[model samples]
Target: MLLQTAPAPGAWERLLAVLKEWDFAVFLKINTVWTGAFGDFLMPILRDQRTWYPLYAFLFIYVIYKFRWKALPFIIIAGLTVVLTDQVSSTFFKNYFGRVRPCNEEALRGMARLLLDRCPSSGSFTSSHAVNHFGLATFIYITLKPYFGKWGLLFFFWAAFICYAQVYVGVHYPGDVSCGAVLGVLLGGFTAWIFKKYFNFGNRKRGDLTTASPTV
Candidate 1:
């Protein structure tokens, strides 16, 4: 006869306590919306990926102008960064966590101040917006850090604001955004590092990660 070992003392309880605390904090923020202007500003920025098409196209074009054909490889890797972050955050993490989005929460129906009249019909433990943008930001930052120095940091701030907008619109909790951002950073930073190492970026031996970093 074997004796079963008990789970770590109070560990589950502590975890539950932390989750409850976070949910309480989320409740506070969801009801704080104050302006039509804010919603107008954030909705366009937060929901529509197409809204940034011109900027994305401009970046691709600008990179090509700066580095010519060498820019093609980095642009491809950038696409991968978006795919990794968006898919993992939305498909895997959201389903695995199975937490209901604030917008979809029955209890929050009356309480949460919504920007759009509609909410997506999906699980929302992780914010896809945060993940995609942050991941892209991290990749871009690492790729261009050598040439642009401290200026590359702006990408992280840009990603953060997008995540904040998700919370403001009552779609995701702050924890969801925070966790998504962490995952994005890891995915982007690790991928960029790998690209650099494999491509011999330090010596520019086999087409380094960057030929000329753009100021934009």
Candidate 2:
């Protein structure tokens, strides 16, 4: 007789099972409630690093004043890279994949009770918030690493917080956040590198190049 193996669970079924597990359920409930109560409120605030961009711009301007006019072009290039990469990832990849939000699926409907409210019927799989925030964080951290030294780790935490907030709010899956983070890091780093090589932007000491830290 031929040996038979058990079939693998479908993606949706696996997601449901993961959601049903005790630890994950607890996290899901806590995150759902916390994010639900404030998810929308916080989303507008944290969605883009745009709010923080002005502050960074001011800082970079100050750096230019302290350093040299050459820094202006670098700052402008870094800022534009962050903005463009973030917009492309959020607008194109997130929508193109067009995965359904976790709470919107019938397979996971029972887990909905743990959610603060129904998940939005928008595209999922990759979180815009995660992509934008992480992308910005990665770009900024890489740009400033030469100056901040170990302080760069803080940006990783900042990105992680933003990405986790997505899952907590029931808008994305762990997998979605994970993939978004990876994409964000790659895009952010690539953008930064391109500007550094072509435009000679930011602090581009040859040794300063580094990979983006993981989030989620």
Best by lDDT: 1
Against the reference, the lDDT scores of all candidates come to 0.75, 0.64
Q: Mind giving the per-residue lDDT tens digits that candidate 1 earns over 20-53? A: 6777576555436444776767665665677667
Clash pairs for candidate 2: 35-39
Q: Residue 148 CA error for candidate 1 (Å)?
A: 2.2
Per-residue C-alpha lDDT of model 2 across residues 1-216, encoded as one tens digit per residue? 988999989999988677546434554664555555466567545534465667566767755764465566667766676677667766787688776676675666666432334456667767766676677677767766666668877877877876765676566776677777888788888866765566543444555444222111
Query: What lDDT does model 1 reach?
Result: 0.75
Per-model TM-score versus the true fold: 0.81, 0.63
State in Å the error of residue 43, model 1: 4.3
For residue 22, give model 1's deviation from the true position in Å. Answer: 2.6
| Cα lDDT over the full model 2 | 0.64
Q: Which stretches of candidate 1 lie over 4 Å from their true place?
A: 1-9, 30-36, 43-47, 200-216
